[model samples]
Target: MSSHAPRSPFRAGAGAALGAPALAMGVSFLAFGAAVAAAGLGTGWALGASLGVYGMAGQLVLLQAAGTGDPTGATLGATAANARFLPMAMALAPWLGAGPRRRWLALPFIAITPWAAAMRVLPGLPEAARLRWFLGFALVSWLVAGLATWLGLLAAPWLRPPLLAALLFANPLYFALLLAAEGRLPASRLPILAGIAAAPLAVLLPAAWGLLAAGLLGGTLAFLARRPWRRGGG
Candidate 1:
């Protein structure tokens, strides 16, 4: 029964993986808010985008579209930017536990940071603890990002352009580093290599489609390359 003692998911998850990514997410959202303000949008608009969209890439696309005075393009761009979430959700489903209801409840929080953190940590946790840990980690990250967005909006008047740009690049840089760390594994090597090869080529594609193309092409190539090894292992 001692083995079944209650554990604090919040503490566990936070202690394990929430610190750096949460800070990176907060900085990224701060940059988003600053960008919105610099583009002449109100704080309320930035807050609304943060709350409703909750996607950094999509929010950036929306900001660009709004700046260009193209609402329709913004909508389409945001939608396209968010399309990556579908695959992310699919990849996370198995770890999130089995139930339509649970997945529905959890899917809203399935952003890149939380997903990556959960994926890195969940395999070692007991099955019973995985979902709770994920929820706790995601909740803290979401709250931190929202708060940082608000703060950034308030501070935008005093922030310099270069500093804002650094903030904007923070999360993506962190993510790249995380991926680099993960690439130490044999299976991740091929996918990382393929992505590196495809990224420059993908830039030749239309707006917002390049990332999608790069990911699809890279992932497909990686899967094909890994198949024989997987089959042999099986």
Candidate 2:
């Protein structure tokens, strides 16, 4: 029999991507909006950042850095955080359509996030389905965030800190809920461990460096730890 894997349920569940993933993106965008407003950024600027940067974590980091009078740091931070997109891009490459489609789709990849990528690569999905799921997930993120940022800026003084905090908090909360639902066996534990370890390290290490380390270390450890299919094995 052919060894080709069956289609991923998560991919077919692209509909769900429009749900939870969209909600998460909206919440994060709202938070980013608040932060930008508080920092005295104009609505145009906030929206521009969302459209251009598309990375909630990176955007937040850049804004914080900018608030501290370090545009250089903000630039560096954004760049560093964006570096993680390379692996995600590679994962997504297979599902993308040919030629200009791949190149065009790659544009939004700049804003790729763990949740977005995870939703796109939903296990057990077919290639076409995975592509659709990813596009939907990414589109929702762009729209929701752009709107939220605009709203946050328009509201300004009232929404800044709390909304930003909520947005930041929402990401992990969403992940935890998802993990709780999906994390039953030992094999699934590696991502959970890496997720737990990632945040604190992201805060400690230089922006994107933390993500890179976690991905490498967590992936390597998981690979090494795998055995037969009894309890845990790939």
Candidate 3:
């Protein structure tokens, strides 16, 4: 009788696959923590937000609202900022492909970076290993983000505005580069172009509204542009 190697739930490549995105998220969260500290929210609250909310945009919204001393507005703002996750969940549903309980449990780990990384990596992974890899990747990413938040909060006292601005800029730059890496696809071009064209106009709108508008317009244009190609199988 021949024996086969036992199946491993974890992939050797899983940890390394998300290293760059995890580092980028850590830096972004470091900036976020500094911003929160500068706002006088303290490290505990910042770390708590990292663990509980795990969303940079929503945390920023909460901080902004707290500054205004408006609890209701803060709640609404955070909700609106996090509204993007709903569509994100829908988009990821097919990729996750598991029992409801498992997918539901993993929902908290969903974020822009993880979603993008998973989209790029999961297709190549066996179905059984995908969830495990995602969970492991997300855990490491979350820990890095949380630790960076703590360090940033501690270092906030010494950081200057320009330095903090540069730190904050890293996240967007990383995301832009990620998108550019994927821009070889015809479907991506129209949306990227639309977003660029819409940026100035978006800036004139309220912050949340502006993001929503740009995404909707850009995504709509991309969808329309892709229809013909998709139908033609080209």
Candidate 4:
């Protein structure tokens, strides 16, 4: 008889990310890889941005600004596009730990996909398991994004024009799918509903500010809707 080691929670979490969501993420980054190749930024830059930026929209923003030959504007644009991460990190903090040290370690990984999945999945997990699970999932997702970016760049030049257009929609479509999948959970749906409903009103602002407003507003509404003050002794 052969024996296999029992998987840790971290490995289990990573396995979860290997499914449909990760596939969509990889498909979506194909466009980004193409864009990076088109931009002449090289594979190193594409992979670095995929890891360091983490957000698809932010990577696009950085790519666009890079063309202007102004590193400052590129940096600012990417930062602005990813401003939604501020509220996300805040919302995820209590789940990671009460200590700033733990929070800081995990906060950097709070991109849309992992954060959304975490919000939907973490409450049911043991407190000790949540952080490890989250890290495992997010790290795998990040690696997949980086790998897809390189592959996309290599394949982009050979891909048909129409196929490239289709790839661009994959990420947003995955987000929509995730929202629908999590809709069964009432608590989890609150912020998603709020963000979608409020995003239109935010259109008056710049893209980054609009993103920030939607995330902040949605997170605040969800937090308050839960009425933590009554529940909190912390």
Off by over 4 Å in 2: 1-17, 67-70, 97-106, 109-126, 181-187, 194-208, 227-234
Candidate 2 structure quality by residue, lDDT tens digits, 114-171 = 3445543545565445555555556555677788777766665676565567767877
What TM-score against the true fold does each predicted structure earn?
A: 0.90, 0.72, 0.86, 0.85
The residue ranges of model 3 lying beyond 4 angstroms of the native Cα positions read 1-14, 228-234
The lDDT leader among the candidates is 4
Which candidate should be chosen as best, given TM-score against the real structure? 1
* Tens digit per residue, CA lDDT, model 3, 1-234: 335764444444346535677668877888888899888888788988887778788888888887887888887778777677777778776777567678776677887777777777777877877777677777777788899999889888888889888887888888888888767766667877887877775688877567767777777777786777788878
State candidate 3's TM-score: 0.86
Clashes of each: 0, 5, 0, 0
Candidate 3 Cα deviation (angstroms), residue 1: 25
Cα-based lDDT for every prediction? 0.82, 0.64, 0.77, 0.82
Which prediction has more favorable lDDT, 2 or 4? 4
Look at candidate 2 and give me any clashing residue pairs. Answer: 7-124, 7-125, 8-124, 8-125, 9-124
* Candidate 4: tens digits of C-alpha lDDT, residues 147-219: 8998989997797778888888888888888888887778767877887877885698876567777777776
